[model samples]
Target chain A: MDLLLILFETGFWAATVRMATPLLFGTLGELICERAGVLNLGIEGIMAAGCMAGWTWVYFGGDLWTGVLFAAFVGACFGLLHAIFTVHLGLSQHVTGLGITMLGAALSSFVFRMLLPNITTPPKIIPFAPVKIPVLSDIPVVGEILFRQSPMTMLALVAVVAVAYVLKKTPAGLALCMTGENPSAVESQGLSVFAIRTTAVVIGSAFMAVGGAFLTLSAFDAFYIGMVNGRGWICIALVVFASWNPGKALVGTLIFAAFDALQMRVQQQTAVALPYQFYLMMPYIFSIVALIVMSRRSAYPKALLVPFRKGER
Target chain B: MRLEPRAHTSMAMTILVPVGAAALALMSCSVLILWAGASPFLALTLLVKGSLGSVFALSETLTRTIPLIFTGLAAAVAFRAKLWNIGAEGQFYLGACAATWLGTGAIDLPPPLLIPLLFAAGAIAGGLWLLGPTLLKTRLAVDEVVTTLLLNFVVLLFVNWLVFGPWKDPMAMGWPQAEPVVDAALLPPLVAKTRLHGGLLIAVFAAVLFWVVMKYTTWGYEIRAVGNNQAGATFAGIPIDRVVIRTALLSGGIAGCAGVSELLGVKGYLTLDLSPGFGYSGIVVAMLAGLHPLGVLLSALFIAALSIGADSMSRALNISNYIADIATAISLLAVLAGMMLTRYRIRFR
Candidate 1:
């Protein structure tokens, strides 16, 4: 009865959907990059940059929606930097990505310190409020779980459908997949591998940033250092579990978020007097388990981590 | 413009490229300095003065480089084998835990016996920490990057649990930390008045040893072969799995040594903030060294001075000490370009 009471609660499912929003963005972003045969290790830092960019925009008196766009733009700039090295110069994607992560996180931290030298606590902004859908909100439990949410969550759902549709149906999607699977084949088709891959990385990085922005702009009031807190890394694991499909990514993210939400509930409700750190470690431990469980069955991009030179055989 | 293959990079280019990249990094930092309302020129002088102005400053910088050398070698060794051990931070913490567990009243012994025992225990613990991920990668086709990175959060939480729950120092009025290591376990001071310790000798020795092993040994040759092309290395009769597992042990062990080096030499106990991202910084150091063992020595020193210099610069300017991190990140990015230039030349039509 107790378990049923907790499971049937609408608030828990709402929290699950709320937590899934950022991860959906991140998993989709990573799915885009990996589909184009690039492993963006920079997702963690790009999200951090997004968190800062969106919050800083709002903190400096910009409106919420523009803050989201600005975060995407900033994410794109870092993407350009990543693309220049990994796509253009053909450096090791691992090192380049880790460097980008450091740069993004450090730059945001530096800018934050400069902007607010004297404040002890992080400055708060008017975060995105949950907006109710008229007809849908009146419906039963599913309506509360899905319809009554932040606009960013709706945008994330739209992105998932859009990404899934584009990847499955569009001409551009075919080119992107070819660029990942076999760049030489794509090149022979008279399309520039460089162009397609760069676009995917840049666009993918933007989604990652939006995922980050959702945290500060919608999920929480202000940015704190390390607040991204390995969500980016977990999203990478989720993408693996999703097997590179946007729809599956949405499903995987929701499931993971449910577990995360459930853990928080259990930690709060349990009277066993457990240390909170163990509960905090669960997400990471779950991701490692997820990777092992799902890694074998997934079909990876063929040219992943391989640099495609212009004319080398 | 396009990149064209260079038949061979000249001797001058090899030396000039990294130097130019480092200078480019410095020039970019000047912009940040200007943004912080300080003159870049004076800041540069102060950075130099702060990092190398006196014997004390030099010792502090050297003391900082000690752990970097171990972690740098850790990353360099694993990266050479294409192991992708991003969990050096986690391994470093676990290593510190081992030192804490054994060195803190588990068994009391003289300095000569206790110090080596602690270092050995730390290395084994660190190696075992990575062994699990490496096994998962080798056996199950799982990607180690994600697992290793995620483990950092896991290990940090574990450390939090230990310090706050079981290992709490009751003497310190509830500030969560483990008990200090016995005095016999303490590293002999390298300089009387400074924080510098004899662990610098161990680190330098480790670097020299790594240089020899990486450059000359047949095992080293196998590591390079596997990293260059795993398919080729497998075809050439290399046991891919064994080499990876072996490299994991060595790499993780080195990173673990860094933790012990910090615990025994500097802090003398385990705490939450034992490292200010030394494990992550090791990746920066290794890449900047181009994953060369001897190069790790100089690059570690450079990174050490840069951060220490920034700390000093922050005192004079209104800027935060994070400027050094920005500068280091820029230099690493620049190094990527410099790395490419060494292998190719740009052509415009």
Candidate 2:
């Protein structure tokens, strides 16, 4: 009973929230892109680029926020490249996205080696620290778990609300959604589906970049190869799990993060003979299960991977 | 300018597109080399010399090409049916595990029986690894993309658990590796004083078989029809579901062979990082070949040479080897961009 209570302690919840912060950013970014009819598989590479850009900037005396902004800019550039390929040139989404990811990963590694050659110890920067909200953080368990959090975590929550609002109550969001569902309908409504999709890809990629930046800036201080480590891929699955809803994406991210945090805690504390790698595999397994259950009936956008050419049926 | 579909694409343009893309990619990659503080010309020359200049270099390049050929054929076969088996990486690992299990067993089987058994074990394991996703895709109509991709992570973790827990060698001190396979299980080297092995023959034979089957077989005709237009194929009485399942099995089985070849023919034991993204690279090769089985042979060799050359280029230029990956990626993108030119013509508005 005491062990169970320990598992549910304030620290665990805090860790869960911290873990979910990056996924929250990534999921929302993917949601925006998918909602606009472009499946950006370049998330993996874009995130890696963001990780490197942010780490390099912060390592070289740039302000942390500046590093974050730079990462977002780089991510947006990748998004632009994706848009030019899938949107304008009408290439295969799978091929183009995968290509960008390969390029981004290679570029990041190459640049990292050039910048920090032959270091015995991995380089580090002072990461973002938790800030306690006045009066709110003093209010017992809730305050300890939620009120005392990093700036990035706070921004993640705000983003959820902002995205939900934009998606539900705005004309632009409706256009974006329509483009994914039926480009013909969107075209009949006198809106440029191309412009909306491009905008969504750029903005969505910026969010993904910020998510990557959060990993290097908030999750840890050092940039390493494979650091993004399929998190972007997880977000892609989460978008399906959440059924293209931003609010549900937040919930899904939290659930995945909670499993991760719990697994780490259990591996550290339990005397069980099970391999610790299974603990690491929990979130991925859960996502797969969720996909198996929900994918058949999942409300994917109709024109999600289809390229739109003007005046074509 | 606006792009319009061509009534019939010319054969000359089909060959011209990828080469043009390669040249374009080479030009862009030079900018990256310039950023790395090296002369692009020097780096390019070094790459060619290092990958193909000497007999030894050519041998190493061919050695790399061995696994790629298997994987490329894996993708080519499945893509021909329009099935995306993204779990080739997972299948490779699973196949390796099976080969390792059989190879390290106590039975003192003769070389002929033991070698073929190991190969068969790998093929079976790879097919089984893909069974779940294939069933889900065919039966429930679930998107194989997400399922297959996610399975890669799951199977990788499974392999990690095996190496770290049940299969960890007691003699290696702390390195994560399984016990070495029996000497009979190891592939015979093809060349003296080179790492080239008999597995290259298997890869070549598989590529030839794929080309022959895809070109001459009735099943191949049906698969091509289904890939081009599923509804049309169904209307013409092709068993689409059966085709999908069969294709997935063969695709995964060939990928499994790639893993076993790497294990028995090269590494000789199960270890982490065995693939080095061979599965993902297979997709690149498949696309570069325009999903043709015969073309896969040439594309895989091209890609293998590029990576092998990148190592020597990096050593000579004092730059990161990742430059090769960038060059490969740029080439892939350029191919996609140029591919449009073969199928469509741009007209000034």
Candidate 3:
């Protein structure tokens, strides 16, 4: 009975919130970008840039919110760079995204080394305190799991709803969808496809940056090299798994997060003595399997990877 | 916008285009240096000297080039078939794992047999690793690019798990690494004292073999046809799906060889961060090489030189080694833009 209690309290559900935070931020950001028809493969780089930028800013006496904003700004900058290459210069999105990622990785490492010169210890920061809801504080497990969390969690939920509203309900959202689906048709209807896409990419990148910042400011307080790890790529996969829906993205992110959390929680008790590498492989393995299965049933945007050209369908 | 049949001028222009693009790339790097308050000329000179002037630096550059060559060939092969296999890094790690596992206890043959068997194991492991993504892509119309990239993370985590868990060096204090391979398993030195090893030969041999197969084989011809125009190839009765799978598997296999080389030749043991983005760098090399085997060879060397030089420049100038990366990005952009110019003349409206 005690062991069962430990399993219940320490299993997947208990670890979901912590694991889900980064994925939530990343997937939501990627969802927005993909819906806008700009597949930003540079999400990994953007996230890394955000991680370093957020960590650096927060470490140097800056407010956590300020660090988040700075990370978003950095992501926006990368988005702009991506936009210039893909939209303006008409470069291949894959190549441009890879280049941006390389640049981001190099820049992150360089800046981290330059700013945080030779410290034996990883720098620590006071992370965001989990906020308990006044009315729900007394409630059992559900309330504690749902309500007692950092502001970022609530913000992620709000962002998802807002994104769903913007993509499905608003006129601008309609135009954005039209641009992604058929830019020439949208243009014929007097909409600016380039403007829509550029804005989407920038805003989408900002979300990714914020997500990266959350990883640093809320999840771990310090940044390590490759700290964003594969979260950025995971976000990209989530976009596909969600079938380009923000709400679906949330579900996918949560599921993935739960798995990750379970892996962490069960590390001590699992008698299989499987290498931690096997555990680390779980999320990625799940993601690929999820993508393969989902792609069979999911409906991707019609013009997902196609670059739009003016006066050409 | 149709080109006139001016064959001679076009040929001459094609020959000179890369040179012009290189010049433009240099200018861009110089501008970046100026932004950093450094002299471009001095930086360029130092970069050149740092990469090639010293024997140690030259060997290091070659060492870096070894894995890149395999990854570049891997990307080039897959891209030629329009397969979009983006998990070469993951495949490389898998290959290394297989090689390590085999070298550890599975094989106890002589040096020649053991080494070749290890390479074969690495290749098979890499090929198997990509099988699922290829199947998903061909059978279900799923994008291999996304799946492959995701698998990379999974492979990386697997490496981490190994280093931190079962494979953790029993003798080491706390470092996440496996026990060093037996002396007989280590790659023989190429130049006796220098860091250079026989891995460079393997990379070159792979490139040559790929070039021959791509140029001569009927399968290669079909792959190129499908990549160029799937509908046309299908109409012409080419087995498009089969070709795609074959190319993807071959690419994965080649990338796997890179893992073996790195493990046996350079690193000698697996670690979490074994690759300093060699898989990613392969994308740049493949692109810069225009997906040609010969081009991949040259581009890999140039990239290796730049990476080596970047480190040296850092030591000499106290500037960040990342300047080399910035240089690579600018060069890639310039070269890509130059290729575009060769195909289409841009006209402002």
Candidate 4:
């Protein structure tokens, strides 16, 4: 009973928000890519690259925001590479994404070693402080958990709203959806399917990069080798779990985040005899269950993973 | 630009595309070398020398090639069936865990029987690890890519739990590793002086067996038909679901052999870092080999040499060993790009 009370505390919610912030960013990004009929498996390496890029920029005396911009820029370039392979060259999406992942990971580690060689202790930067909203901070539980959070958390929420609006209400969104569902239809309608997909992939990757930047620049002070770990992969699973709906993605990400937050707290607050790895495995297990439950009859984009050439079947 | 499909691809084109792709990858990677302030010529030389220059280097390269062969074949078999078994890493760990369990248990069996039993245990465990994803893919219409990738993390944790919790070595001070297997369980060295083990022979035998199965068997024909066109295969009376399950079982089983080879042939104990992305690297090998069983052997050896060479180049040139990874990724992308270009000739509008 005491543990249940601790689990519902404002601090626990705050941790949940922190854990969910990166996933939200990555989930939103991958959602856009998948909705546009391209499964960007490069998210793992792109997120890792962005995390390292953001940290390196900040370490070189750039502001946190500028560091984030650099990460987005790096991510966009990688997205372009993915677009060239999957769209222009008509290669296998699975292999292309995996190759991009391998490339991004190798480049990030290589650049990091060259820049920071042989440091016994890893260098740290000042992470983002929680910014309390003026009136919102006055609310009891919600204010403490939601208002008193990193700037990235607020931006992520705004991104969800923005993505939902753009995908639902805009002409570009309709065109993007059409491109994913049937490229021939979109091409017949005189919109360049390739161009729309390229734009979606680039913008989506930028969002993913920001999620990664949040980890290094706001959530944590320094970048570690496995910092991005499988979070990017989790985002991929989240796309299927959420059925590619931006609003549902927000809810799904938080559920996964709550699991993560609970595990972190349980490891700290109780003398539970369970292996710590079990805690680490919880979110993945939950996501897998979510996928199994949600993937069937999910109505994925029709042309997903199909390469579109002008008149080819 | 417009691309025109060629009715027939020539024999020369088949050999030339991969070589040209490799050369292009090397040329592109040289830019990174230049950025790192190293001579590309010297780095290339050191890479070749380190990988193939001496008998010891050659032996080490072949030793590394052993696990890769099993994994490469694993990917090759699955990719040919278009099943996309990407959980080789996790399956490898499960195989290693099973081998460790059987080898360390107090059975006191004879060497010949013990070794084959360990191999079977490894293969069975790997196949079982993939069973969940296979069922989901076959029955629920779930995407295997996410499920398989997720299983890798789950099994990795399971392996970690085994080593850190129940299987922690009693003698090691603080390392998270399993106890060493009995001597009778270890694979005997094939060469007298070198580290080469009987595992190489098994890998080669498996490769030949895989080639024969893929080439001559009716099951292989069904697998190819399903891969080329699923609906067509079903219309032609092929049991698509059964083929998928059997292929996954074989794929996972082959990957599991890689784990057993590593344990009984090389490490003799389970550790967290046993596989350095062999499962993932196997994908690259299978793709490079065009998913051919025989070709996987050559590609695996080539990749193994590149990795071994990269280690030496890193030490000699004071560059990060990840340069090899960059080169490898470029090679994969280049190969895909080459294959695309080779299939159709581009013409200006």
Candidate 5:
């Protein structure tokens, strides 16, 4: 009974929160980018860059906020680089995104080594302390999980709400949506498709960087090699699972986070007799299965991966 | 709104383009070396010497090239059929897993019997792994690129699970790896003392066989036709859907050979980090080779030389090992940009 209780409570719920945090940030970024009609496959690389940048900044300066801001700035720079390739240079979006990812990975490792040479121990920052809302702290299990997260979680929640509002209610959001769905139509209305996409790319990438920064600054506080650990890719999958809706993406991210958390929890107590590798494989396998099922019913943006050229309908 | 047609560059100019791009790439790579506080000239010399200076270096380079050759061929085959198989890394991992399972659990045969069975198992595992994405592309009209790339993470996680969970060596301490396979299951050494093995021969043979099929086989012609134009091929009575599926599966299977090479040739055991982006590097190789099987062989060798030489340069000159990766990236960018010169002439208005 104690073993079962440990498996159900701490293993499942705590793991879920830990797993969900990075995915939440990543998927939200992807959701915004895809909704704008430019698929940023460079999320993986960008997140890694953010992890290194954020960790390095916090390590030296001892300011987590500054680290996050620097990460966002770095992400925006890469976003501009991606925009140059896809928007101005007329390169394939997929190829450009892949190049950006490679560049990000290369740059991260290069910078990490240069900054922290001959370091026997990895430097760690004091992670953000969890905040409990006054009234919300009195609530049940939901309140504990939702309100008792670090400031980054609160930032993520705020960003989701803000993103959903902008995507649905704002004129800029409509223009961005039009640019993604039908660039020619958007352009015909005398709006700059390039401007809308560039903005979307920059903003979307900032979110991804923040997600990465959160990993280093808030979650673990020490950046390791390949620290993003496929969370950027997980975000992409979540975007698809959510049907490109920020709200749905939140749910999707949580589900995946829950799976990850459960896997960790199960490994702790279960004598399931099977190789633990099978359990570790659960989240990825589940994501693929989710993708396969979602692909059967989901509706993607019409011009998702297509680069828009002027006067080409 | 009218534009004048530009004159086509001469054949000599076209040839010079790649050479010029390569020179530019070299200059760009020098910047990285300079940043690392190493003399560009010294670094380049060390790189070349480390890759090809001695018989041992050459053997090491060949050992590195073996898996790349398979992955490059895999990417090339899929690209030729216009079905992007970005999940070559995952397929490679799955292949390694299957080979490990067969070599350790299922097969108890002699060296001759076991080796072939392991290779076969690896290929079939890779092929089956690719089947889901291919089906999605053909039946659901889903994009294969995203699906294949996504599957890579899934396979990576699965491989991690295996090594860390069930396949953890029973006798060994807490290091996350499987037990090394029996001597009967290992690939025979190609050289006297070096790490080079029979996998290089398999890679060469696979490349040559692919080249022949692509040049002479009817199916190959159909595949190229479909890649050139799906509608045109369909109208011409080619089995377009079947060709896509077959090509994807074939690519996945060939890529799986990389797993076999790694397991039997290099590490002699399965670990989580078995691949250092061999699948992704295959993209650069495929692009550099212009999707040609024979060209993939050469590109794979070049890339392998760079990787091996990079390590040597790091040891000899104290340059960061990443300088080599930067060089490879620059070369890939240059080659890809150089290929553009074949189709379009850049002009300033």
Candidate 6:
């Protein structure tokens, strides 16, 4: 019933992974964008759009995987819109990103309401089912914590590995890093920095949308206004805590999710005297602490928010 | 397409671009109107008429514009100095809470004295709220964007805790809201029945004051200097950190004022839905105004009109009021691109 006891529960870590799946997708998505020198402030709205897109797709008689893909596609379109402004037009990243967030969030909600204006209760969809990783899920407590989850969670795990592998060991990723560090150098290398940053933002946005889709398509059954809440912003902070590294992002996400999941369970404890709102505040408070802790050491991409103009530099 | 800086921006381009951009944005959104089974033209008519057709409608839009102006000024000020204070929404709430705490039977004074005192308290609360994020950015190189944004959630949840717990009004039959402020603390109504109140004067005064300060003052010069080119400002002996911190306080104070204005002038009590994303929409207003202080006033009204109009349009057409949000966002982005077009010419090769 105490906080410590809640941390030891197998259910706690399992929920932690489920929660982390979205943060992981978001953090990794943000990580990818920041790594390539573009800050996708559109994560929140992109996730919202993804949530609606995936739910609508599933609601309209599509398979879950394809629904996720549709969500990613919706996310990618927004990413493309963001890229057109920030990446290509070289507009202010902060303002442009915020604009995209608004567009994504509002448009999705508008579409949702337009689709179901009269439904008093939000319609639910049958979501992705839990799938155990055959051998891995059969092991000790660790297996139960890490392997038995919805397919979306497994995709999140695979995404982290794929992101790490590509970022650390691929030609494309090297170009991305180069773009973030010294775009002039990247341009001199006969590569299009615009294309690279655009791709990163698009892919990162897609990942963020998938992270959002995981919520409605797996964790929960219906999309609600503000359900994504501040998860996307928290991931933005996690990116800082992780120092823009994919592997570290995974660790950071789990820690965040563990704290998040623990707060939920702790809130249920009758002995706890604090209001539940304080428990809800745990993730945001943790984000700020994480930011303060990592601020000094966090080495952000040099050109992260810097605009790239061809031949000008 | 590649872009090249224009040697001189023509006045016509400056005027045409924003108009063209807004038109394009609205045109793009007609698809949604059509899908909603309403004519885009009719929806547009409903929107304009709902927001501005009558004195009553105009008063309502003006009521909504008050907070937008305060929040818009907050964003315009901070963004001018290169501080990204996205937590205006949170600061607004904190301001509201601070005002509520003091105004709800805790303090009573004559209207002339009490209103100013509450505004001052709210500004201080909002300013102090942003101090942490600003200091982090200046001292430790933390990004203000994420920290400020995260704090917004924390502040809201804190408010949620307050309304549902200690601050819950026992007199209000089962509503999760604070006790209403003393009558003396409330802003005098400008109209008999409409929500319009003296907040309009304060908001307009604030806007004009900001415009003058930003355009003429030495501190304003420092803020603009630091924002335009930090390294150059550093070379010129401007204290970049101090300016940024000062900007944070002022920006946050303005946003905080929005909370007090809403709490006193309109709602008369603190509730979870007091500002209704006024902080986020403030960014849109600031952007639409091209970060100009006086421009914020115009843009706030413009945005208020859009929202007010959309509300009526949605009610009539069975559409969503979120369309107005879509319109504002589209305009922000389009204007961003349009502003760039004035400075740079795009050529496809």
Scored by lDDT, the top model is 1
Per-residue lDDT, model 4, residue B15, is: 73
- Residue runs of model 2 more than 4 Å from their true location after superposition: A1-3
Candidate closest to the true structure, highest DockQ: 6
- The per-residue C-alpha lDDT of model 1 at residue A224 equals 97
Q: Between prediction 2 and prediction 4, which has the larger TM-score? A: 4
Docking class of 4: high
Q: Looking at model 3 chain B, which ten-residue stretch has the lowest summed lDDT?
A: B1-10
Superposed by TM-score, candidate 4 places the C-alpha of residue A144 at a distance from the truth, in angstroms, of 1.9
For residues A1-313, write the lDDT of model 2, one tens digit per residue: 5457766699988898999998999999999999999998899899999999998999999988899999999999999999999988889888898898898899899899988877767789998899999999999998998889988898998999999899889998888999999998898888988888999999999999899999999999999988998888889989998999999998999988988887787788778747877777777778778777878879889999999988876
Compose the digit string of candidate 6's lDDT tens values, residues B1-349. Answer: 7898899999888767767767877898898888878899999899999999999999999999999999999999999998999999999999999999899878878999999999999999999999999998998888899999999999999999888889999998989999999999999999998889999999999999999899999999999999999999999999999999999999999999999999999889899999779999999889878899888888899889989988988898888899999999998888888999899988889
Candidate 1: stretches off by over 4 Å? none
Instruction: Sort by DockQ, best first.
Output: 6, 1, 4, 2, 3, 5
The complex in candidate 5 yields a DockQ of 0.38
Tens digits of per-residue lDDT for model 4 on B1-349? 6567888888778777777766787788788889889999999999899999998888878888899999999988888888888899989989998999989966689899999999999999999888789889899988888888888999899988999989999887889999999999999987777777899999989999999999999988888888989999999999999998989999999999999999999888999999988998888888788788888888889888989998998899999898878888888888888777768887888
List model 1 lDDT by residue over A1-313, tens digit each. Answer: 4556788899999999999999999999989998998999999999999999999999999999999999999989988889888998888999899999999999999998999997899989999999998999889998999999999998999999999989889999989988899999999989999899899999999999999999999999988988999999999999999999999899999989988998899888887657899889999998889899998898999999999998787
- After superposition on all CA atoms, how large is the RMSD of candidate 1? 1.1
Model 6 clashing residue pairs (backbone):
none
Q: Global lDDT of each model?
A: 0.92, 0.88, 0.81, 0.88, 0.81, 0.91
TM value for model 5:
0.90
Best by TM-score: 1
TM-score to native of every candidate shown: 0.99, 0.97, 0.91, 0.98, 0.90, 0.98
Identify the CAPRI category of the predicted complex in candidate 3. Answer: medium
Off by over 4 Å in 5: A1-18, A133-143, A272-274, B1-26, B102-117, B157-186
Worst 10 residues of 3 chain A by lDDT: A2-11
List, residue by residue over B123-169, the lDDT tens digit for candidate 5. Answer: 99999889888998899776677778877877887778778877888
Q: Report lDDT (Cα) of residue B45, candidate 2.
A: 91
Native-vs-model 5 lDDT? 0.81
The residue-by-residue lDDT of candidate 6 on A21-117, one tens digit each, is 9999999999999999999999999999999999999999999999999999999998998898899899989989899999999988988888887
